[model samples]
Target: MNRKRLEQILDVSLTMFREKGFDDTSVMDICNACGITKPTFYKYVNSKEELLRHYYDGALETLIQAMDEHEPSNDYVALIWIGLSMTASRSIDLGPDLLSKYMILNFHEHTVTARYSAGGKQRTVEAIRKAQEAGQIRNLCDPEKLFMALKNLSLGLTLKWIMTKGSFPFFSHYGRMVEDIILPDYDTVLKQTGVDHRKKTG
Candidate 1:
């Protein structure tokens, strides 16, 4: 497979998805935009849905970087909420129509959106574990469970946001979910006030 050609395909595909909407954009449309044949498009991925999933491959890394920006702070709780808000805002910027395609496939096949979007996020689990270790979040529930909570929160909120025709307040609602699910079991952890690391540039 030609990595350069594949990158070109993905770039064009993402642009088409953004401009034309994922449902309306056919594989032939992508091939035409990329100046590739059906066979050539197939050489890189099985289907257009598969190619869209590839876009999500970077979303995990994006979330990790968002979380890491607030690290080394005693207030892991705030950091987690900040990450959720940031990712939620990013999704809104990505547009709801594009994500709706994955949500549709996710219901039946349980593919990329099921795994990468929802379950089996080890990095997210590790972040939760760190907060748990620091007594910033409830330690009774395992980090794995907390990760699932995050995924569930994100998925549900995103779906609703899409269904509402972009009217839903995803960032605010997501923050509430994080506070309800991952916030401390006690009050002491909440008292760790610090700088708004979200504003920190480093």
Candidate 2:
């Protein structure tokens, strides 16, 4: 397989799916957009659904990488915020409709989506455990429960954003939730943990 060409096809297909919706975007549409013939497109992917699966995998891979790259800090809240921001930005990049379709397809499955979700949850649980050990999380709740709360909040906000057709500002909403509700005493936590809270700016 030509990796570069495959990427090009996926990119074009994602754009088409985002703009045109899944049902409306034909295989020929994707092929024409990629400047490839149907046969060539078939050589890479068997169907439009497969193309969508590839797109979902690509986005999930990005989030997994971001989660892995986050360095441990006493400001573990910031680390969580960074992961949330990355996820929100990726969903926004995919646009609402494509994201909705992706969610619907694998929302209840033990598939690629489930694998990514499990990996992300594991990373989050680890982060929470570290924070608890460092006394950043004063509540001393179960790490798994805390992780589930965070995950639910993130998923709920994303669902709302999609349902509203992108009228909602997910990134800003997530940041505010982190700053005001989730970690209102984040600065104090950092200080208590003897770690300076250095604000990360984009």
Candidate 3:
């Protein structure tokens, strides 16, 4: 098949998978949608499962790319959260069924899981270290504990969105909440500590 046709097939397949899920969507569904025969579909992908995995992994690759592009700052946690929110927003548009499939099929077994678990922990820990160096975030909390808290918050938000049938605009609202939790206004923190902002950098 040509490059454009292959791209078209994958696009339609993702849409169908998002709508009907992996198990429910069949080769016939993809072929019918793409106006091709079963033989043609099979030429591109061996099975619907493979297609599902490909699309899911593609989304994850996008997330990792976004994370890599984020530049560290004094509020590293907040910056990471912003990048994560952008990733979340992109993933959500890929369809909830596809998202749910990702959770069900590869939540514990995929490359993305490794990145989410191992890579994310490292990134959070490193960001905390940076914050400690900058004397911005408090060092009282263990880096691992902070990482878990942030991850749990994001997962909880995502799960709630799924359960509610997408009732909330999660990425937008949740980003603000995460920001407040991770990086509250610097002036507010200073004022709370009895440091007169007006006398210093204020």
Name the top TM-score candidate.
2
lDDT against true structure, model 2? 0.69
RMSD from true fold, candidate 3 = 6.1
lDDT, candidates in the order shown = 0.69, 0.69, 0.62
* Candidate 1 C-alpha lDDT tens digits along 38-141: 99899999998877566655555666676666666656666566545544554576678877776776666855452334422665666677778877676558
Write down the lDDT that model 1 would get: 0.69
Q: Point out the worst 10-residue segment of candidate 2 by lDDT.
A: 107-116
The TM-score ranking, best first, is: 2, 1, 3
lDDT of 3 by residue, 1-202 (tens): 6867778888998877767776788888889999999888888778665665554345455555655665422445444564355445555765666666666656655535322545545665676656555555554467667666767677778777777777878776676666566554456435434444245433
| Residue 98, candidate 3: C-alpha displacement in angstroms | 3.6
Residue 24 in model 1: shift from native, Å? 2.9
Give TM-scores for every candidate, taking all chains together and pairing residue i with residue i.
Answer: 0.73, 0.77, 0.65
Worst-scoring 10-residue span by lDDT in model 3: 189-198
In model 3, which regions exceed 4 Å deviation? 1-6, 17-25, 35-46, 58-69, 72-75, 106-117, 183-185, 188-202
Q: Which regions of candidate 1 are displaced past 4 Å?
A: 65-70, 82-94, 112-120, 138-140, 184-193, 196-202
Question: What are the C-alpha RMSDs, in order, of all predicted structures?
Answer: 4.3, 3.5, 6.1
